[model samples]
Target: MCRWLAYSGTPILLDELLYKTEHSLIDQSMHSKLGVETTNGDGVGVGWYEAGEQPVPALFRGIGPAWGDVNLRELARVTRSGLFLAHIRASTGTPVQQTNCHPFRYGRWLWCHNGAIHEFRELRRDLMMAIDPDLFPSISGSTDSEVMFYLALTFGLREEPVRAVERMAGFVEQVAKAHGVAEPMQMTVGTTDGDRVWAFRYSSVGKSRTLFYSTELNALRTMHPELEVLRGLSEETRLIVSEPLGELKGAWQPVPESSYGVIQKGADELGSFTPR
Candidate 1:
């Protein structure tokens, strides 16, 4: 299991969210209250889209605890982006390395996941074989997270993210069942195309990991009128995380079980998720 967060809204310094909150992502990296593990020290990564014609988002990954990385601290202090993703890893069984870090990227899209395939070693070969030949060569890590990203890509992520991911989950479960694994998959996945962000929470088993999205900015302002931070953000601002960044009342809303949500320019959407 791992912990991650996605931010989309006004371009503010990264530290504002990664370090300034009561339980920031950096804080959660060491003391996660809701994750399966208390310390997610295997590795860390951040991916963000700059405001420009270039579609590709920038990536910074390191194979060390995020809280101990001076480089990560320096970068977060000075950088700003309207949309970004940050993850702290906790290896289920894979090696700890930079290439295995989250926020895996292809073209203009970014993705990260916080759960695993129940018996990945037994199903890896079959799942790998199912990936499109042209896309298979791009896989750079051994973690199931990266494989899941490419699997989504191969299943039409660039065209239809929701459908592609549902297909990806369905395919993984199908392979795992063949291998005699009862509960084959568990994931709280977040992805974006530098424009809109999509997040999903689901598992073959009924219970899944924790996930939540921030309450609407306008509503938060009304709820906590004195909070200065809420004033600077736009109504469209949004955040989805593996846990609440803070205990601020009305600041976070749990994503429903086995569901997905999208954060874009207009009204955001929350809906049921079903693997194809």
Candidate 2:
């Protein structure tokens, strides 16, 4: 279980989301209300796409807690990105290590996940063998979270993200059922390729992980005029997070269960999927 966020829109400093909100991601690092754990202190990570460059993303991950990390604070104050993924980890069975952090990257795609694979130890070896050997060595950590990233890649994430994820979930469920592990896999993942962003709120049980996305900017501006940060952001800029960052009532919208939402540079879209 973890608390995470995905931002896709106008370029803005990381502090705008990481440190500024009343109940920001940094705040959730210590006082999360919706996650499986109240405090996600295992580790934290951030990944963002640089503006006007290639689509590939750069990452910054540390084994330290998000609230206490000095480097995170300094970086938040200076770094800005139009597409970002930030995560606070609560390790289930895996050890807390740098490679285990979220916002895993491969080529042009950036990804993060919030949830765990049921009976990870039992299925770890089987699933690892399924990944393409070329990509397996790049998986530096032993967390089931990171393995899911490579699984999506093995199923073709680079070519078709939506289908890749669906197939990966299908494989996980299949492996779980064969082992008599009836519990469903839970996942609320966000991924992007610099031009478009996709967020998924899904679980095999149909009661998925908690996730949210922001409403249109014009409406927020109309509602809260005094908010100075709103002036710097564009009309198309949007944010998706595991929980509401602030007390602004209608500012956040819950992503429908079993749905995948897409935010391109110019348009927004959502589609449905059935988790097998």
Candidate 3:
């Protein structure tokens, strides 16, 4: 498994979430309490959309432990984004390489996953075959995470993210069941297209990995009026992560199991998720 985070709202340096928090993503890369593995050192990646009319997000990925990556630290200190994704990888089985890192991108979208397709080797060929031919050539890594991204794209992620993901999950299970894999999927996926973000938590066995979203900014502001950080953020600011970034009281809420949420400019939404 892996540890990842998605942030949207007030523009701020990436380090605010990557390094400044009590238990930041960089800290989780070394001492994760919620992930299956304590150290997610295989690789690290960050993707973010620049302020303005840029259609695609920028990416910085490296095949090295995030905690020791000076390049990543330097970049995080200087770069700011209103919307971004950061991930620290712990390879399930695939080779640890830059291309295999998370925050996979295509056109105006960005995606990252923190779980696996059980028996991916057994299901790889079928899964790969299912991707649209035009999209298949865009797959640059061998991780099931990247394949899942392309699969979602093939199923129409651009038009309907939640439904496309549901279909992607359904299709993976459909292929896995045919290969006799009992527990076919485990995932906590996050995706965005510069303007909005969507996150999902689900698994075939009904025991998915941990995922949490930050409490509403207004509520947090009221609860911790003394905190300086809370004052700078907008009401629309939101964060979804594999674990709580800090121990601030009432600062985090668990995303319900087998459910999904959407964060946008107006009112955000949390709803039930059912695979097709």
TM-scores, in order shown?
Answer: 0.99, 0.96, 0.99
- lDDT of candidate 3 vs native? 0.95
| Tens digits of lDDT, candidate 1, 128-233 | 9999999988899998988999999999999999999999999998888888889888999999999999999998997999999999888899899999978998
Q: Which window of 10 residues has the lowest lDDT sum in candidate 1?
A: 49-58
Residue pairs with clashing backbones, model 2:
none
- Better model by TM-score: candidate 1 vs candidate 2: 1
Backbone clashes in each candidate structure, one number apiece? 0, 0, 0
- Give candidate 3 misplaced runs (Cα > 4 Å): none
Which 10 consecutive residues of model 2 have the lowest summed lDDT? 267-276
Which residue pairs clash within candidate 3? none
| Each model's Cα RMSD | 0.7, 1.3, 0.7
TM-score-better candidate, 2 vs 3: 3
Question: What would the per-residue lDDT of candidate 2 be over residues 146-247, giving only the tens digit for each residue?
Answer: 888899899988888888888989899999888988765889998887778888878877788899889899999999999888888898889999999988
As a whole number from 0 to 100, the lDDT of residue 179 in candidate 3 is 88
Question: Which one wins on lDDT?
Answer: 3
